[model samples]
Target: MSVTIETPNAPLADAQAMNEVASSIGLDWVGMEGIALPIEIAGRPVSATVNAGIDLLAIENGQKGIHMSRLYQALDELTQSELTPALIKSTLTQFIISHQGQASCAHLHFSGDILLSRPSLLSEMRGWKAYPFEIDARLDHQWMLTLKIGVPYSSTCPSSAALSVQVAQQQFSLDFDHQPDAISVQQVSDWFDKRGLPATPHSQRSWAWVTVTLGQDAAQFPVTELINRIETALSTPVQTAVKRSDEQAFAIANGQNLMFCEDAARRLYRALNNQCHFDQVAIRVEHQESLHAHNAVALAVWKRGSHAA
Candidate 1:
C-alpha cells in the first residue's frame, strides 16, 4: 500500500498586526535605540551609536506597533553615504514613508568621535585627536538639526592666577626691599631662578560642551570647522603630541588665556553667535578644579536675535 502526503503552503502570521491592545492611547515615540551602525563622518568611516524612532500617532488603527525592521534597514542603507544635513533629512523622510500613515514625525540621533590630525603647538609632529560629537535630527512640521561636540582645553583659574601674582609680589618685596640702590641683573635673575614665582596658579583640564541649531541652508556637518572655531575662541585646546617647546607653548597659552567657567562660556557664545550657520547656540563649560574636588560649570544660550544668557 502506497501512502500519499500533502504539504500546506501558508503565509506566516504577523504578531504585530494580529495582537493589538484594546486601548486607543498613542505613544510619543516608539522605535529602537543603541543601534550600532557604521557611518561616514568628515569623509572618514566611523563607528556610531544610533537611535532612530518615530512618533506613534496612528491611534485610530489601534496602534499595534511600528515596523522596526524597516527602520533598521533604512539606517543600514546610510552606511554607503557620508552624513550630511540633506542625507539626514532624506533618511527621516524615508522613515515616515516606510511607516506609511503610522508615523508623522521622525527623529534620528547618532554619536561618534571624529578623528582629526592635530599639529603640536611648536613642533612639526602631528597626532590624532578624537572629538566626541553628536547629531540630532527631527522632522515634523519643520526640520530641525542640532549638532553637539565636546572639546577639551586647559583652564587656568583667574582667581588663582591673581592670588599667585599677589604672592609673587609679596615675595619680591621681601627679597628686594633691602637691596642696594643699583641692583644687579644677575641678582634678580638668581632670585627668579631660586624661587620660580614663589607660588604657581592652579589649572585644570576643562571641557566645552557646545550645541548649535543649524540653519536650514547648511549643507555640510561642519564638524572640523566648528571644532576649529571653538578651539580658537578658547585659545588653549589640549595638545595631542608635544615636545619641550610645544609644552612651553601650551603653558604660555594657558597662562595667557586665564579664565573661569563663565569666561569660557562667554567666549564660545560670542564666537558661535557670529556664525550665520547657527540659528541657536548653547554652551556649557566645565572647569574640573584642581584645587577642589568639585567642578565649576557655566551654561549659556543664544538665539539668533535674542540676548545671550
Candidate 2:
C-alpha cells in the first residue's frame, strides 16, 4: 500500500528538528488533535470503540509542535493496554520526558460516553443508556500526578417540597371552604396541609467531578467504587427508563427524601472525604428547577482527607 499526505506541520519523528526550533523560543504546551484510539475505561470496556483525545506539550520555549506521529503511536499503545488513571499518569510522564520536560506539566483529557445497563422496575425489562464521562490526567513536579473523573447525576431540593405542600393546602381551603363542592378541595387541602407550598423539593441534573493524587506506580482508579459512592450519596438517582411504576417509584423516593443541591453536594463531599485513597476531591451539584427559570447550584471541596475550610 502507498499513501500521500499533506499538512501544515511536519512528522513527529523529527524531534531533533523540532527541538532546535523550540529550545530557542519559550513555549508551554503543544501536540496533536482528534487522534482517535480505543481506550479501556475503568467501568466500561469496548473494543476499538474508545477514542482518546491525545496531546503533548513542550516545556521549552518557542516550540512549534511536538512530534504528532509519536503522540498518535502512544495513543495506539494506550488502547491495546489498560486505560487507567495510573496509565494516564505514565503517559503524561512520557510526554514530559519526550519534550525534555521543558514545560513543568503535561495533561491528557479522555472523554467518551459509557453505556450502562439498568433493570426496569416491575417490568423486569433491561434498558441501556450512555452517560457522559471523562478522565483528566496531569503530571507536575509539585503536584506529582493528579487524576480527575466526572459523572453526571441529579439533585432535588427539600425546601421546595415543603413550599409545594403549603400552597396546595391554602388554595384548597380558600376555594372550597364550607361549600358543597368543598369536599374535593378539602382532600387537596389536607394533602397540601400535610405537604406545603412547594410540596416537592426541586431535583436538578447534576455532575460530580472527583480528583485523586496517584500513589507510586498507580495508573487507574477504582472507578466502579467511585460510581457506587456517587449513586449511594444521591439516593434518588435519575433514570433513563420511565415506565408507569418507575415514575411512581421515583416520585415516591424523591418525595420521601427531598434534598437541595447543597445537600447533594455535601453528601458527595463527605463520602469522598471518608475514602482513604484520594488525597483531595471536589463535588458540585446543579439543580434545574421545574418551578423557576433559574438553576440552583451547590459545591463542596475536600483536601488532605478533610473538608475544605
Candidate 3:
C-alpha cells in the first residue's frame, strides 16, 4: 500500500504568530476588517454579508501598530452558532484578555438586508422586499456596548400645502375674473380654506441614523424596538408593495402629517428622548427632495437628560 501526506494551512495560527511580533514591537489598532460572512436576518437565515471592520485600539502612547494576525485569527473562531450576543460578548472579552487588557477598545461594523413579505391590498399577493440595515457595535473598557442603525423612510412637507393652495387659488381667480356668474376670488378662497383644497403636500425619501450605548449592568434593550420607534417617529415608512388602497392611504397619511427635513429630525429626536434608552443620543435625518436638485439634511445630538430643542 502506498502512503500519502497532506499539510493544512492554519489562518488562526498565523494570526497568533503575527500578534506576537506586533506586540513585541509595540503597535496600536491591529485587526482584520472587510471580511465577508453570511448571517441571519429576521429569522429568514439570509446571508448577513458584511464588510466587517474590526479595530483593536490601545490607550497608551508607546505602542505601534497592533498584531493584525492575532485579530484575524480570533475572528475566524466565529461560526454560524457563535454569532449571538453571548458569543459576541465572550469574543470581545477574550480579545481584551488575550491582549493583556492593553487594547482597551474594539469596534465592529455589520450590515444586511431584512427580507420581508408584504401583502398586497387587493390581490393579497405576497411581495418580497429587502430593507437595508446596518449595525455598528463597539466595546470599551467601560463595559459599554454601542449599537447604531440606519433606517430609510419618507417625509411629506406640510408647509408646501399652504403654498400649493395659494398658487392654485390664484389660478382659479385669474380664469374666473371676467365672468359675471363666476364666484368672486374671496368666495373661491373661502371655499378652498373651508375644504382644505388647492393644498398639495410635497414628499421626499428620508433616512435616520440612530446610535445608542449601554452602561455597565445596563438593562436589556431590543435593537428591533429602537428601529421600530425610529420608523414610527418618521411618520412614513417605505412600502414594499403598493395597491390602490395602499396608495390612497399613504396619501391621506402624508396629507395629515406633513413635515420638513428639520421637522423630521426633531420628531426623531423627540421620539428617542422619550424612549430614554441611553443617557446620550445622536440623530441625523436627510431628505432627498423630489422637486429640487439638491438634498436637505438635519442633525441633532443630546447628552443631557432631555433632548435638544
Q: Residue 66 of candidate 2: its Cα lDDT?
A: 57
TM-score versus the correct structure, for each prediction: 0.94, 0.74, 0.73
Model 3 stretches astray by more than 4 angstroms: 1-25, 41-46, 49-73, 76-78, 81-84, 98-104, 118-126, 178-201, 215-221, 304-309
Best by lDDT: 1
Cα lDDT of model 3 by residue, 85-165, tens digit: 555566666666666646676655566666667554345556775656665555674454555667777788776777887
Question: Which prediction has more favorable lDDT, 2 or 3?
Answer: 3
Off by over 4 Å in 1: 1-8, 61-63
> Per-residue alpha-carbon lDDT of model 2 for 65-179, expressed as tens digits?
5554555566655766667655666676676666564455666766666677866545666677565555556567643545555566655566766777677667666656766
lDDT of each: 0.89, 0.62, 0.63
Please state the error at residue 271 of candidate 3 in Å. 1.2
State the lDDT at 30 in candidate 2: 61
Q: What are the RMSDs of all candidates, in order? A: 3.1, 6.1, 6.0
lDDT of 1 by residue, 1-309 (tens): 997645447666676665366525667898899999999988878899999999876455464787789888988667878888998899899999988877889999999998999999988989998999999999999999999999999999999899999999999889899876977899889989999888899999999999999999999988888999999999999999899999999999998999999899999988887788899989999999999999999999988888747
